[model samples]
Target: MSTLTAVNPLTTLERRALQSISTSDGNMLIVAADQRNSMKAVIKDAPNGSDAITREELIEVKADLVRHLANHGPAILLDPEVAVPYVVDEGVIARDTALVVGLDASGAETVDGLKYTRFVPGVTPRTVRDLGGGVAKMLYYTRPDRQGTDSRIFAEMRDLIAECNAEGVLLIVELLTYQLEGESDEDYAAAFAGLVADGAALAVRAGAKILKLQYPGSAEASAAVTEAAQGVPWAVLSAGVDHETFIGQVATAVANGASGAMAGRSLWKDSLSYDATLREELLTGRALPRLRELADAVDGRRG
Candidate 1:
């Protein structure tokens, strides 16, 4: 991580957008329900897989998630496809809770086992603002250890950053690292922290203002990410880990310097079900507590 300074001060609109998605104390607790294909896969793999689930069913799931979880956090991440216009128009999300729309496509294309990101057609920072969203999120795959692995993606990211700045919307650049082809599991695990730290630095250099990063594997690595961010606020993503594991990660991360968390599956994976009544029970009984716990973890360490 370098000690370089930010390129410029945030625009007034950008500053307000950032405030809209954070607590009064300035910590961020974002509930991410923006998954598309992954959520569909979860629904399809259920025992009942009797019929192909329709888009309405997926929207219902997303609505249920937003209905149950959005108010508990400062912000919620929803995709433009099923969740955004529907959730916003229907008022499923609370008025006070900020909305973050994901701009990336559901799943990435793979070439030689390396994943590449694709954006949803016609979605941009301006599109997010037009949707009444305060934040726009873009997820990209990277391998920081290998130079030029994602140069094209990096270029796109730079362009998006410029667009977001011009549009006066806050952009949260999310970095996801994958195990490369022919890499051993052990080696991948060993290199996880470095990859995350380097990836964050790379994003920051690309002019990312806010970051949603994978848990960097240790307290030391977490601190490195904060250092790499150079005072730009960053929140650790849950990455589908269980609630208990994610709680520990949030604790270590915020204690070191993370602003908060942006989590999805970890907070509500088991709560999802086709049975509406049962889903409510699990979301209320299991997921809500996890959200509160994670929020407490972040708030407790607030500076």
Candidate 2:
């Protein structure tokens, strides 16, 4: 199947960013840890965790993830609030490691099982570049059904895409779906494919260079999403699923034409139960092996 040509030719910087994030073989294995308010919530609920954490602690935790994990080769995604600043200033990011800065805000509220996301002001592609970010990433929720439409979000995405293109920065757009009111589990299951495909199509049309998306149930459904992506590089997000399930999804997504994965929680969320030292140990011991498995999966597909 033929893929669509990029709306704008990839700039040298964009190409460099893509290469830095991917393996030497050009297979992506980006590890997304850029959760803001959500991270706080996770930390709060973690076993032996705190209800409230200092900004310093947050930075330490995120920095630890980069220190231990990002060095392993997968590109790292970080939030602008504390993680990005800490990583860049402290030189936690290695020269070869790809650095992605999160541009979205932290106020995603659930309305009847559906999520409504709003963009936070202040972080732009230019700011991301200035902060030494190789790629600027934004995560937003969308649905195939019109009832989930947010014109403001779409408009923001368009502007961000234009800005990234003009500024020579790579943009990674993450498309997630939510359950709407009166929608049963069966209804959601039925609409999953169209939602994933439609969301990818919309992001590509808005000029996303790379898309971070949910798995569309099966390889066949994922193929339709790949078809809709029109040649733009797309990766599967973990969505907090267990490591095994996510690994399978990554393999399936790549077999069906996805480039690779931009996953978060599934990779390291399990390691959140211990103190700093033990946390790092569990993350390094447990998470690294999982990533290695994923990398192998991607490599197999590329082969």
- The best candidate by TM-score is 1
Question: Which segments of model 1 are wrong by more than 4 Å?
Answer: 1-8, 44-51, 111-113, 148-150, 301-303
In candidate 2, what are the lDDT values of residues 1-303, reduced to their tens digit?
113465545677777778888876687778888886566666644454554676787788888888787678658988888887778889888777788888888768775555666555788788887888868888878865663235555666778889888887888898888777888999888888898899888777676778889999898998999888888888888988998998888888888888888878888877654268887887789988888888877765422
Candidate 1 global lDDT: 0.83
What are the models' TM-scores? 0.92, 0.90
Write the residue-wise lDDT of candidate 1 on 153-260 in tens digits. 678778899998888788999999989989999999999988888888888878888889999988999999888777777898999999889989998998888888
Give me the runs in candidate 2 sitting further than 4 Å from their true place.
Answer: 1-8, 41-48, 109-116, 147-150, 301-303
Q: In terms of TM-score, how similar is model 1 to the real structure?
A: 0.92
Q: What clash pairs does model 1 have?
A: none
